[model samples]
Target: MRIGIVNDMPMAVELLRRLVVSTREHQVAWIATNGREAVEACRRDLPDLILMDLAMPEMDGVEATRKIMAETPCSILLVTASIEANVAGVYEAMGHGALDAVDIPSVGIAGNASSQSARLLTNKIAMIGKLVRDAPSRASGRISVATDPSPQRLVAIGASAGGPAAVAKVLSAFPIDFGGAIVLVQHLDAQFIPGLADWLGQHTPLPIRAAQEKDRPQAGTVLVASSDDHLVFKSAQQLGYTSSPKDNVYRPSVDVFFESAAQWWPGSVIGVLLTGMGRDGARGLRQLRDKGHLTIAQDEATSAVYGMPKAAAAIGAAVDILPLSAIGLRIIEACGRPT
Candidate 1:
């Protein structure tokens, strides 16, 4: 796959350049020092993908991504270095149409900064390549739903990076009586999510409904987080969507739902982090794990991009790392199944 790298830092630009060179299937088509250059290059060359940096000097990645997507239309993968102190900015970039993100490794940490940087960058590049080249085509495969329905506990799932197809696979695997609530957060456009929810619901037994401002999460139904607002749970056992201050990078963030589950149901909550491109669910999953709630992540093999799951695993936030098919069964088992 041909890719473009956009970053103001000379070291980061060189690092990414080497990474793309080493990857057998990927090539760096062009390198832009700022968002303005990125936009111009994208319009000129139209690379297959872009590795964007959030904090550029002339123009930021978010605006550039918006322009590139509108005019040139290519997949964008954000690469930044400040996740510990500034994770929220990453999500803002995503909201502006950047597909996913990765942390830029510290320069000169290993024996060879160039090679180490390349190795780290290579993994992310390959994943983005998969998303750019594989997801749309692969989304057409028949989704497999689970057959048994004796379980009683419902599970709510929310994610962003690489989530659209991953959520569908897990939902499609459950049988009609899987016995629980299934809420989702896919970090998609508000106007289009209703249609996406409907499309995803067609493959699952539990019909997908958009979550109203004060609706309660009920059993045997799949409730999706509303677009343009954050979905949280109140002490009254009701779902609340508010325009309150955003906590993490993504407003309808996985952290909000997973953290709420930990608070609302404690041990009864089942939180699953699927293929995504950031750390949105990592902290919330940790909270769930600490509270003895069930936490799971989609294993690397089946993930369209494993960023979110990888983040959860890195922090010991997940109790299990399973493939897409096994996640639904794990949910059923956690909800207490016939097995």
Candidate 2:
């Protein structure tokens, strides 16, 4: 894959160059000292992917991402010195189309720190490469609805990247007495789950909490997957976590949860794939659609990173391709609620 590097610090740029060259599977296509240069470079010659620094002199990563995407779209991964410190900027960039974020690996660290960081960056790059390769020819498969279309009682949502805000928007649209259970699988670091839950709860009328082992999902409540393990269902009401799909890159995978729901949930189910990077929820959303459940994917205009829903739509997994604002109302109607 051809990768571009953007950072203000000379040393950081050199380190990233070394890291990319060391991989051998990828090549450094170009280098930019700041956001302005990065945007100009992208317009001239767009790389398959970009390693963008969050903080830079003059234009910042967020603005660069916005411009590059608006002009010459490409996959972007935020490579920053401090992820915690730049959390807001990271999300902002993602909201504007950046795929994901990772801490820049420190060269001076001892022990296995360097190796661990290298592994993380390589894995992310490899994932992005696959997304780029498959994006162009992706086909949305046939949308199959259940012949009987059971009464909707469960809603399963999956999102990553710009998910927190998107999830909140959908959840907030529900009334306090929403007569169904909501299972949300968001790709986020484990440490941030509590804070994300609190943030989403603040915007929604339904009570929101992280899923607990052996807990049954209750109507009128939202269960956010909390663990690093994939969240799945043991039965119609019971939720469980597993490390069985240890090879899968995404933890608390949206695919895992949606597939489990297709098997366990007896009633009509509503599956939603929101703004996110990669194709994690695409296959699972298809599974739900094949089972006759209503499946929705966020349209590109409203999606922060359109990868997941794009994949879903490409492969015919989504029964409806709607904007983010319309999803909640669609869910409510699917659940037999009046418009």
Identify the candidate with maximal lDDT: 2
Model 2: per-residue Cα lDDT over 37-130, one tens digit each: 9999988898988999989999999999888877777888899999777766766676676767888987764322377787888888887776
Best by TM-score: 2
lDDT of 1 by residue, 196-226 (tens): 6666776786778888877766667888887
TM-score of 2: 0.83
RMSD of each: 13.8, 5.6
Q: Ten consecutive residues with minimal summed lDDT in candidate 2?
A: 138-147
Poorest 10 consecutive residues by lDDT, candidate 1: 136-145
